[model samples]
Target: MKLLKLTLAVALICLVSCAEKGSRDTAEKETAVTEAPAEKAFKYWTWITADPERTDDSYQEEFAKYKDNGLDAVLINTNTDPELLGRLTPLARKAGLEVHAWLMAMNRPGDSVALQHPDWYAVSREGKSCFDHRPYVDYYQWLCPTRKASRNHVLGLVEGLAKVEGVASVHLDYIRFSDIFLPIGLLPKYDLEQEEELPEFDFCYCDVCVAEFEKIHHKNPREMENPALDIEWKQFRLNKIRAVVNDAYEIAHKHGKILTAAVFPYPEMADHMVRQRWDKWDIDVVLPMIYHNFYNEEIDWIGFATKQGVQDLKYKDTELHTGVYVPEMSPSEIKEAVQLAKENGAKGVSFFDGPALTDDMLQAIKETKEGR
Candidate 1:
C-alpha cells in the first residue's frame, strides 16, 4: 500500500512537470510568431517644439506625459538650437522614448542665411518673391531650390541637427512649394475658388528656375499664356525640390541618421497643388498628414490615403506613418484611424502636435498598445 501511494505521487509530479514544459514551449512559439520577420511593431509618435518646453524646468514632467502614454517616439522642433536639444535629449532617453529633431527644410522664415540672399527666395508667376509679397501666409518665406546657395544652406542645417547625439531621426517639414492650389475644402477660407490655378499662387518662377527651364525647353515659361497648363514647367519645379531633398537625404545618411518628412496626404493631389512629388524621395519614412478635415474628407478617406502611400512605397524601402490632426478627432475616432491605417499597410500613426493629446486620446492610444 505504501509503495503504491509513493508511485502515485511520483506520477503526479511528472505529469505536472511535463505540463509546465509544454506551456513554456507554447509560449516560446507564440513569442517567435509575434517577433516574426518583416512584421513591424506599430509606432505611435507626436510632434512638439522646444521653445517653451526645453527652456522651462517643466520639460521633464512634459516628456514624462508622453512616455506614460505609450508613445514610441517624439518629434521635437529644437528650432536649430543645439544647446536646447542637448539638454532635452537625455531626458527623453531616460524616459525610454526616441527623439527626432524636426527642422524646416525649404521654408525658412527670417532665416539669416536666406535673408542675406534675396534672390534665393521663391518667386511667383506674377514676378513676386515670397520674401517680400508674403503670399497666403505671412510666414511663407520659402527659399528657391534651384540655387546652389539654397541647397548648401539646407544641407548645413540638416548636418547640424543629424550630428546631435540621441536624436534618432531628423524630420523635414514644409519641404515643398507653397500651395498653388489649396485643398478644395480650405479654398473657401482663403475666399478663392481654385477651379483654375491662379497666377497669384503659382510659385518658384525665380530667375534661376526660368533660365533653367528656357535652357532645357528653348522657351521661356513666363511667356506662356497659361503656365499652369504646362506639365514641363510643373515637372521642372518638382525636380528642383526633389534634388534638394535627395541631397539632404545623403547628408542624413552620412551621419547615420534616419531622414523622414511630413508631406501632403495624397501624392497626386500634393503634386498638383504644392508640386510635392514626395513618392520619389529616397528617405526612410514618410508621414503624410492625413488631416481629413483640411481636405473636407470623411474618416474613411484616411484609410484610402494611407493605402495609396503604402502602395506607392511597396517597392521602395520607405515606411508610411499616417499623420492625423488631433483637434478634429475624438477618442473613438483616434482608435478607428489607427485600425484603418494598419489595415491599409501603414506601419504606424503620428499626431501633428503634442498639446492636443487629451485624456480620451491617451486612453485610446493605451488601448491600441494593448491590442484591444
Candidate 2:
C-alpha cells in the first residue's frame, strides 16, 4: 500500500507538470505573434512644374507644405533643364521631400535642337510629320525612337537629369508613341469616334523607322494593306520604345539614379492605346496614371486597375504607384482613392499635380496616412 501510494503521487505530479509545460508553449506562440512587425507605411507623392522665376523661399514653403501633409516625394518638371533641377533639388531636400527630375522624354515641343532637324520628328501613317503637322495638340511633337540622332538626343537629356545632385530619380513622361486611340471619355471633347486604327494618329512611319523595319523583316510597313494587322510592325514599334527605355535605364543607373515613368493604366491597356508595353521594359518604378475619370470609370475602378497592374508586375522588381487625378476629386473621394490604392497592392499613391490639391484634400491625405 505504501509503494502504491508513492507511485500514484509521482503520476499526479507528472500530469500537473506536463499541463504547465503545455500552457507555457501556447503562451510563447502568442507572444511571438504579438511581437511581429507591422507593415511599412505607404508613400505619397505629387507632380509639380517648376518655374525658374519663382523665388527659392517660395519653393521652400511649397515643398514644406507637401512634406507637412505627408508627401514623400515631388516630381518636378523643369523642361529637362538640369541647371534648374540642380537649384530646386536642395530646396526640396531641405523641406524633407525627395526630388525627382521630370522630363518630357519623346514628346518635346519647341525643343530648339530637335526643331533644327525637322526629320528627327516622328511621321504619321498619313505621311504627316509631327514636327509640322501636330497630332491632337501642338505639343505632341514626339521624336522617332528608331532614329539614332533623335534617340541619342533624348538620352542626353536623361543623362543631364540623372546627373542632378540630390535628385531621387529621373521621372520620364510622354515616353511612348502618340496615342493610337484616345480615351473614350476624351472622344466627345474632340468630337470624334475611333472605331479602328486611324491613319492620322498612327505614327513613326518615317524613313529611318521604315528602313530599319524593312531591313530586319524584309517587308515594308508602308506597302502593307493593313499595317495594324501585321504583328511584326506592331512589335517593331513596341521594341523601339522598349529599346529607348532600356537605354535610359542603363544611363540612369550609370549615374547612380533610378528610372521611373508615368505610364498608362496597365500593360495591355497601355499597349493597345499607346504602343507602350511597360511590363516588358527594364525600369525601377512605374507610376501608372490610373485616372479612372478619364476613362469614365467610377472610383472603385481605381482598385481594379491598381490590382491589375500589381498582378502584371508580380514577376518584376518594378514598384507600381497609382497616380490619381485630384483636380475633380472631393475630400471623401480622395480618401477612398488612397485606400483603394493601398488595398490593391500599390506601393504608393501620387496626386496628378501639386497645385490642384486643396487644404481639405491634404487633410484627407494626412488623416489617411495616420490611420485616423
Candidate 3:
C-alpha cells in the first residue's frame, strides 16, 4: 500500500504522450552504471547447486552444457570460502548467467553457530526445552529471531555477499521460525486425550518471548490466550522478525544490491509456520517455494500456488520469481509451470536445487524463450 502511494507520485512526473528515446538514453546509461545486476532485471530463471567443497569439474562441465540452453541464473549455496566465490563469479559470467548467493538463515548447520550457541533456538509454548521445529512434525531446531548475535551473523553473511561483483542478489532461505505444526491425531501411546485442548496450532512461547511480550503488551499471550483468539500479538511477533529482514533489505540496497527472500507458498502458510509478514516488506523480489506435492496430488497445483503468491504479495512493478521443484516434477511439467508463472504476472521461475537437474529439464527450459 505504501509502495502504491509512492508509485502514484512517480506517475505524475511523466507528462510525455510520445517517445523521446534519444533524450532518455543518457539517463538510462547513468542508471545502468549505478545499478548493476539488479538493474539488469532477469526475465526467466533457473538454478543449480554445487556440492559442498567437492571438486567442481563435473559442475563446470554441466554448466558449459547449460550455456547453450539459456538459463537466466543459478543459486549457489556456498557457506563460506571467499575464494570459491571468486572462481564462481567468473564461471557463471562466462556462461552468461546471473548469480544468487543462497545462504542458510535460522536453520543453522550442525557444526555452525547453532551447535555452539544453543541459546539461539526458540522454545515452544508447552514449556518444552527444545528448538522451534514444527511442534511434532520435524526434528530440527531454528534460531530465535530476537537474539542479536544469531541475527547479526545471518545479516553479516548477506552483507559480505552484497560486496561481491556481478552477484545480482543474496537469496535468503529459512528466513523465519522453524516449521511448527500439530499432527492430525494424538498418539495413544502418549496417553493424550482425543479431545484434549492444544494451545495454538504452532510456535513459540519461549521464556524470552514471554518476557518481551509482558514488557510490550503488559500481558501474557497465553492468557490473552491464543493465536486464533489473540491474533494481534501473533502479528506483532511476525513484525518483529519482519523488521530484521526488512532491515537487511536496507543494508543490501545501500550497496546497490537487491534483497530477495524465499518464503512459503501462501500467507497462511507463512503466518502459521513462521510468522513471516511477506505482505508488508519492500523486498526487491519474493520467490515463494511452491513445493505443492506436500499440498495435494493435483498436477495443476504448482501454477495455482504461484498465482496465489503473486496475487497476495507482489505489487505492480515488483518482480515475482516462482520457485519450481526441479527434482520432483517431469520436464514438461517444469516447462509448463514456468510458462504458467509468466502468464500469471511472474517475472521468472527458479529451480530449487541445481545438481539434481537433468538435461531433459534444461531442454524444456529453452522453450520458455519462445515468444521472447
Best by TM-score: 2
TM-score attained by model 2: 0.90
Task: Give the per-residue lDDT digits (tens) of candidate 2, residues 1-372.
Answer: 999999999999999999999999999999999998976568899999999999999999999999999999999999999999999999999999988999899999999999999999999999999999998888889999999999999999999999998998999999999999998889998888999999999998999999999999999999998999998999999999999999999999999999999999999999999999999999999999999999999999999999999999999999999999999999999999999999999999999999999999999999998997
Report the number of clashing residue pairs per model: 0, 0, 4
Listed per candidate, the RMSD to the true structure in angstroms reads 7.5, 4.2, 11.0
What's the lDDT for residue 322 in model 1?
Answer: 97
Candidate ranking under lDDT, highest first, comes to: 2, 1, 3
lDDT of 1 by residue, 263-355 (tens): 999678789878999889888999999999988899999999999988887788989999999887899999999999999989999987788
Better of 1 and 3 by lDDT: 1
- lDDT: worst 10-residue window of model 1: 51-60
- Assess every candidate by TM-score: 0.89, 0.90, 0.78
**1-372, model 3: which lDDT tens digit per residue?**
999988886775553422456558878998888886654443655555555565566666666666677677777777744456656877777777777777677666553556677666766666553443444446455666776776786778778877887788877787876554322222443344433336533455666777787898787865655444576677767876787788788888887889888888766767775677676776888888776665544557667777777787545444678887778788888777877787776777777666666888777877666642
CA shift of 228, model 2, Å: 1.0
